[model samples]
Target chain A: MNNHVFRPLYLALAIVALVFLARYLLVPKDFGAHERGYMYGWHRKGNENEWKAVTVKYKTSAYCKECHDDKVAGISSSSHRFIACENCHGPALGHPEDPMKLNVDTRRELCLRCHAFLPYPSSGRSAIRGIDPEVHYPGKQCSMCHNPHNPRIPTSRS
Target chain B: MNRREFLKNSITVIAGLAVPLSALEFINPKELLADKPGGEKVRWIFLVDTQKCVGCGLCVMACKAENELPYDADVSRTWVERYVVTRDGNTLIDSPKEGRDGYTSQKITMGDGTSRNVRPEDIEKAFFVPKLCNQCENPACVQVCPLGATYQTQDGVVLVDRKMCMGCGYCIMACPYAARFFHPVYRTAEKCTFCYHRITKGMKTACVDACSFDARRIGNLRDPNDPVTKTIMSGRIGVLREEYGTKPQVYYLGLSREVK
Candidate 1:
C-alpha cells in the first residue's frame, strides 16, 4: 500500500483508540451492570442506599400505642380508627426525647377538614356527619364540645 | 482492490468492531448487585380508591410532614383534586391550595369564562381524586434526563438522585402526569418515591397511614397473597393517561371518564 492509504488508515485507528480511552475514563464503573433498557434503569446503585437511608418523620400509630395504650384503645374502637395518631398531632419521630412534646393541632381547619359539609352525595364522606361551619356554632372550637378520642360521645367544657 | 473499495471496507470493519468492543467494556457482569436480599424480587404497585376519598387533605398533610416539605408552600408530593359536574352538563374542577386545607367551597369556574360559588342544586355530581407519581414502567422522565438523575428502582419506584440532578427541569417537563416538581430546599427535581424509605422498611407510606378512609394502598405484584395485589387483579381498576403508554403502576378504582 502507498503512504496515502496507510496514513489514512493509521489516522482512523488513532481516532477510534482515543474514543475508547475517553469512554473508559468518563463512564461510571457501575453503569449498565444490572440496568436494562435504552436509558431507563441505568443509575448509581449507591444512590438506592442513599434514598433508603433517609429518616422518616412520620411514625405509625403503633409507635403511639406503646406509650398511650388507653388513648390508642379509645381511638381504635371509635370512628377515627383509620386515622393515624401522627396525622392530628405533629410528626412524632423525635417526640418525648429531643422535643419531649408533639403539638396537638388545635386549628379549627384541622377538625373542619373532614367535618365541613361538602355536598358530594356520591362520596363516602356523606356517611360521616358533616356540619356547616357558618350555621353550627361559628366561633366555638370543636375540642370544646367533641372529644376526638371518641367523637360519638360529647364532652362538656369544664 | 480499488482505493474506494478498500476505504469502504475499512470503515465498515472499524464501525462494527468499535461498538461491540465498547459495550463489552462498559458492562462488567461480575459487579452487578442483586436487587434485594434473599433473591426475592418485589414489584410495587399503588392503588387509590376514589370512592372512599373525601378530599379531607389528611394524606396531603401527611405527605408534606413525612417528606419534610415546606408546610405553607403550594407544592406537594401528593394532592387531591375535586371534580364537580353541574346540571348543565358542564364539568367544573377545582383543587384550591391543592386540597391541603380541605375543600370548604364548591366554587368552580364555568365554561363561559366565569368563576362563582356553585350552589348544591346546580351540581349533579362531585368527587375527590388524589394525585401522585405513577412510577411508570417505561418512564419518559428517565429517558429525558440528561444526567441519568431520575431512575426506576427494582421495586418499580422512580426516584431522583438529588446530587446528580442539576435542576434542568427536563424531567418535570417530560412527566405527562405532572408528577415531578422542584424541591423548595434542594432545588432539585423531586417526586413521590412510593415512600421508598418507608416501604422498604415494611411500613405503609405516610399518606396511606394518615388516611382516615381506606383510600390509598401499596401492594407488591410479586406476591399473590397481597391484598392490594388481589384488589388490582380482581377489581375494575384503571390508570391515568393510558394513551401515553407509560404503563403507570398507580391503579384507580371507580375512575370516571370525567377525570382528566
Candidate 2:
C-alpha cells in the first residue's frame, strides 16, 4: 500500500518537474534590457500590468532583428533607425517566450510616434503642440513622404 | 451563462454607456537592400525653408541634447547644410556636424580675393536648409523592403520595424533626401524620429525645442485654430518639389530653390 501511494506521488512530481523544465528551456527569454521595458513598465497613465518581456515573441521586431541584421542595416541608415525595434511594433516580450505564438507586427497606433508630416529636427516647427497624426495620415501609409533606407527625395509636394 | 459571466456582461454593457469624447488615445534592411518606409502610424513630412534660415545651428545642438544621441563621427540624423551663392553665379556648399561639442568649417575661395568658410551666402545667395526624412506620402523605400520592415502609419508617419529590418541598402538608394542614417552600434538604419517619443508624450521635438527662433511650427492642418493651419490659411505656404505629388504636409514659409 505504501509503495503504491509513493509511486503515484512520484509520477505527479516528475510530470510537474518536466513541465517546468520544458518551459524554462523551450520558452524564449523576455525583454531583458531595453527602452521598451522602461516604456511598458513606467509610461502609459492607466496601464498597470506586470511587465512580461516575452509575451508576444514571434511578431516582435527585436526578435526578428536577431537573425536579420542585413535587412536592419538599411533601416539603421534611414531616419527610422533611432527608435527601439519594439516601440513601433508593440510589446514584443512574448515572441521570445515561444516562437509559434508570435504573429505579425501590430502597428495600429504606434507608427505616428515619429515620421510625421513636418520634417523632424524642424527649425521653425513645433513637434507637438497641437499636431495630430490621425488627422494627417488618415487611411494611408506613412511611406508616402519618406523612404526608410535613403531619405534624399528631391521633394514631397503637390 | 453563469452568474459571473452575466455580471461581467452587465458591466461591459454599463461601460458602453460611458464612452465619452475624451476616450481615445490610441524596419528595415533586407539582404542589405530592403526598404522599411514606415509603421502603423503614417509618417509625416518635414519642410525646410532655406530662404528664412540663418544657419544658426541651434536646431542641431537641440537635437543632440534632446535625443541624447551619443557622439559619433559617422552618424548624424539631423544636420544643417549651408549653401552660399556668390555674386559671380557660383555656389558653395558647407555642411556642419550636428553637435555642440564642436563643428567644422572648410575654407574655400569664392571669387576675386573673397575667401570664406564656404558659407551659404558667400557664393552669392546665402541660405541654410535642414534635411531629414521627407516622410513622403508615396515613399519608394516601402516598395523595396523584402522583409517589409519599412512601413508608414495611418497618420502618415514613416517608420522602420527595427526588428524586422535586415540591414539592407536598397531603400537607402530609393530615398532622395539622404535622410536614412545607419546606426554604428546596432548596424540598423536610423534618423530623426520627429521626436515622436517626445511628441506623443506632449513635448515638442528635439530640434523644435532647440530652436528659439519660432521657425518650427508644428500644428494640425485639420485644425484651423492651430498656428500651422492659420499660417496656411493666412498666406502661401510652400511645399518643395511640387512635381512629385507626394502630398507632403510639411510646409515652408520661405523656401529656397527646388530640392535637387
Candidate 3:
C-alpha cells in the first residue's frame, strides 16, 4: 500500500473516532434513552420546569359553587348552565382569600357579547336570537325586561 | 485495480456508511415513548365550526390569558381573521391586533391600500375564521428545525423544545401558515401548543372552554365516544391550505371558498 493513501485513510479513521468520543462525553447520558425521538429528551428537559410553574389561574365552575351555591343553583337551571361564572365576571384568581371585588358588567355591550345577532347565515340551534341593540331596547336596559340568568321573558300571548 | 475501479469502490464504501448514519436520525422518540408500560396514546384533533363563530374574539382573549402570551402582534398564538366578500367580487380581510379587542364594524383598509367602509347590507357575505398552528402530520417547521428543538409528541401535538431551541428562526420561515413566531421575551421560537398542559391534565383548551357558541372543539380522534368524532364523521369539514399536503389535524366546518 502507498504511504500517502494509508496516511490519509488513517487520518480519516482518527477523525471519526474523535467525533464519536466527543459525542459520548458531551451528550447527556439519558439523551434519546426514552426512544421518543431525537427531541424527546430535549422537550422533557425544557418543559419540566414550565410544567411546575403552571399555576391554576382559572378555577372550574365547581370552585365557585363552594361559596356561591345559591347563585350557582340559580344559573345552573337556566339557559346559561353551560356558561362558566368566570366567563362573564373574569378570572376569579384570589376571590375567596383576598376577596377580589369583581365588576357586575351590566352594560348593554356586555349582554350583546353573546346575544347580538350575526347577519351571516348560521344554523337554527346555534343562532343567538339577536336584537338590534339600538332598536330593540331603545333606551331601556335588557336586564330591565329580561333576567341575566334567565333571559326568556314570558310573553302575554303564552 | 484501475483508477476508475478504485474510485468506484471508494464511493461505494462511503455511501454504505452514510446510509445508516442518516437512518439513525429518523429514530422517533414518540415511538419509544409509546412502548412504555403505562403510556397512553392520544390522537388530538381540533375542529372549528365556522358557521357557529360570531367573531366575538373571546377565543383569542382566552388563549392570551391562558398562555400568558405578551400583548404583541408578533407573539399571538391564535388569532381571528374577519372576511367580508362584497357583491363586486372583492374580498376584504382584516384582523386588528389578532382580534383581541373583539371586532366592530369599521372602515377596513384593503390589501391594495384602498380604504372601504364595511356596512352590513353592502357586504354580500362575511365570516370569521380562527387561525392557529395546524399541528400537521408532516410539519415543515419540525423538518426545518436544525437543532431537533421542535418535535411532535405521541398525541400528535407539535411543540418546541424551548431549552434546546437556538432561535435560528428557520422553522418560522418554513411554516406556511405563519403560525410560528419568535417570542421577544423568551428570545426563542414560540407558537400554539394546543394547550398541552391543560389537555394532558384532561381539560379542554382555553379557547374551547371560552367559546359560548361551541365553535371550537378539541377531542381525541382515536376515541369512539368523543362527540367531536361524530361531528367529523357527518360534517363537510375542511382543512386550510390542503394543497400544501401538511395533513393538519385542525378541521374546519362551513369553510368558505374565499377563505385563504
Write down the lDDT of every candidate, Cα atoms only: 0.83, 0.49, 0.73
Return whichever of 1 and 2 wins on lDDT: 1
Q: Across residues A1-158, which tens digit of lDDT does each residue of candidate 3 receive? A: 78998998999999999999998987655444233455332344445336425655556577788999999888777787877776777766677775568666566666665566655543322266677666676666666767778767633332
Q: Give candidate 2's fnat, 2 decimals.
A: 0.00
Candidate 1, residues A8-73, lDDT tens digits: the string is: 899999999999999899766765524545467777677888888989888888888889998888
Better of 2 and 3 by DockQ: 3
Report the Cα lDDT for candidate 3.
Answer: 0.73
For each candidate in turn, the TM-score is 0.84, 0.48, 0.75
Which is the winner by lDDT between candidate 2 and candidate 3?
A: 3
Best by lDDT: 1
What would the per-residue lDDT of candidate 2 be over residues B140-234, giving only the tens digit for each residue?
A: 66556565456554444455656556788777776666777676666666656666654444445556544434556555443345555556556
Residue range B75-173, candidate 3, lDDT tens digits: 588998877787788888888778775554445656676767866677788778888998886688887877777777767788887777889999999
Give the CAPRI rating of model 1.
medium
User: What are the fnat scores of the candidates, in the order listed?
Assistant: 0.79, 0.00, 0.19
Candidate 1 segments exceeding 4 Å error = A1-28, B1-40, B109-115
User: Can you rank all candidates by DockQ, best first?
Assistant: 1, 3, 2
lDDT of each residue in B28-109, candidate 1, tens digit only: 1112222444544687888999999988998888888888789898789899988888899977787666788887655664
